[model samples]
Target: MRRGAKRLLLGLAAALLLSATAAAGYGWMVYRQAERAAARMYEPLAPAEPPLAYAAIPQPTRVIEAGGGLGTAGSGQSESAGRAAEPVSGPFAFASEARAQPSPEEGDPFTVLMMGVDERAHDRGRSDTMIVLGVNPARGSMLMFNIPRDTRTELVGRGTLDKINHAYAFGGVEMAVRTVERFVGERIDYYVKVNMEGFAELIDLLGGVRVDNPFAFDFEGYHYAAGEIELTGEAALMYARMRWDDPRGDLGRNARQRELLQRLLQRLVSLETLGRTGELLDAAGDHVRTNLTFASMRGLALDYGARLRDVQTTELAGRGRTIDGIWYYEVTREERDRVRRLLADQLR
Candidate 1:
């Protein structure tokens, strides 16, 4: 062969080899990204107990032991106090009684109360988005439950009947988790509180995500057509935030939020996302807060990751009513029981 032809053949062979190598290692790359993301994303629970003994306080209706079940008993704060203080920054004066729950393990189906808060300056923010994700590793399946923000329920610790999202505004993650647990009649294994503004940065970090828009409408200056569109972080935030124009109102908004989240999860674990690990970590650091530790994250990646591929989402069925001139979503007792049984069966 001529020298030029031989050189061209060599280059082609090299390109093919590189392509094969990348294809073979794509899954491994994604796994590593998950591992790394999980590590940065592990934000442990640090309850702000006002120098009170854990034993002296009345245990929450559902008790979940924290710190790997060793339990923090006395007055020693974590060295990373600044970081620990961020998630629970709400007026927790009356929230001293709330405690963390035990971390779930492999084969143990666990529930997580996901709070997506629209925090404002100096305010802990209302949990505009509330979701319950049930992970059953043994069964290899995932379940999602959307709790309407306006749902009127007894605030677990505050002991007031208010909007379900008020728990977060009143007492932060601990109160939110406890309130949701009591409301659902199940112990929440974990909680992931996300700052809505920061979450937009996260969505942007993932280079945005694609979702099927159910209806075409203009929301907060962002326009959507009746079809699939790739949403930027800001646009995605708007996509999840709008509800007034929808005929179904909050219910319609909730459906869109769930769809966006489901798509976001799928994108997070993709090979494309693996390439943006640094951006992902940056977004996680600024926006996300969770009680999942490094060890438990590893377990999640190893045991539950595969099962999460096929997710089943359920919306808490309820009716809207005005109480004392304020709107509330009144979920029927029968509906709550049905959901409870469904989750229980999945966990089993």
Candidate 2:
């Protein structure tokens, strides 16, 4: 992972933690505040035109009910049609008829593409961090992995082979999502994008996090002992940013990021943090963007939160290569296919 990649993964971790706050069973006032915050964070991606190569790939078919459950395409009317007949209230308000009528014993399996963008003034920066998560509440498990930012692949909408992260820089979230869907050979059910710069503030608001350092090292004037330790926002930022001193280099830094992420997630979901809903939502509203509606989030929390206890993670294998005097992470066809199958099985 490079500097931008490291920064974005932190943003992803914080965004996920804050998003889970919607399921904490808050009172009406807190729920209303969450609804308002969700409204600010909502930025739906426009429909994308698939690339030529992906024309034959059978994309997954799913109808997202207003209540966030999965239904067949012919199960009911469109969400927009349902909205048109009713007065819009809060973000959670949905017409009763449009709600999903899934089997009581079944659980919806869905995929999410989470991106950390390195946006700056006057530039729609690249997706420095790209991760895919497959959640199956019925199995009480999840599949997750990261796509290296420097990987060379088809840029989808742009019709040229280039670094995968460049899709965001060229066409924003729509193109990024299109490119990734083609890469994984599946349709992404939802997306969450976060600007990396705001991640530190989010960590601070959560009262910091705990990480088990594998080795004792000092970077940017912060000394970390080799054991379980607590870090302030700034210290944690530095902790994830150091790679040169690490013998494993980017790989070591990546592991640290994952460890820190797990810690933050545990802290966010704990009973102790439930009282700080307003502050958490406020921080998230400023830095996060997603297509998930408030109603859907609440439904997921209530329905799937308890069942989703087992988590599994894997890495996409690739090797560094230089092409035309530029460095890129090149993944083989076999490797890509293996990952696609893993995701496909999870969804099934």
Best by lDDT: 2
lDDT of 2: 0.67
Candidate 1 Cα errors over 4 Å, as ranges: 1-43, 46-105
Per residue, candidate 2 scores C-alpha lDDT tens digits across 1-348 of 235334535444443534444534777788778888888888887765433233121112355766998754322333232222111111221121122322312467777788877777898878877878877878877787777778767777676667888999998998888888777666676788877766666677777778899999998788999999988777887888787889977566666766665566557656666766688787778778888767666666567655665767777787665444566666665676688778878876
The best candidate by TM-score is: 2
Q: Which stretches of candidate 2 lie over 4 Å from their true place?
A: 1-24, 49-106
Task: Rate residue 294 of model 1 by lDDT.
Answer: 48
Give the Cα-based TM-score of candidate 1 against the true structure. Answer: 0.71
What tens digits encode model 1's per-residue C-alpha lDDT throughout 1-348? 111111111111111111222222356664455445555556665553232111011111221245544333111222121221111112212221232343444466777777666666887767766788777767778787788878877676776667888888898887787777667756677777656554545556667778898889997787998899998767776766676888888778777766766676565545675566544544554555666764565555445554566678788887665444566676755687678677766665
Give the Cα RMSD of candidate 1.
16.8
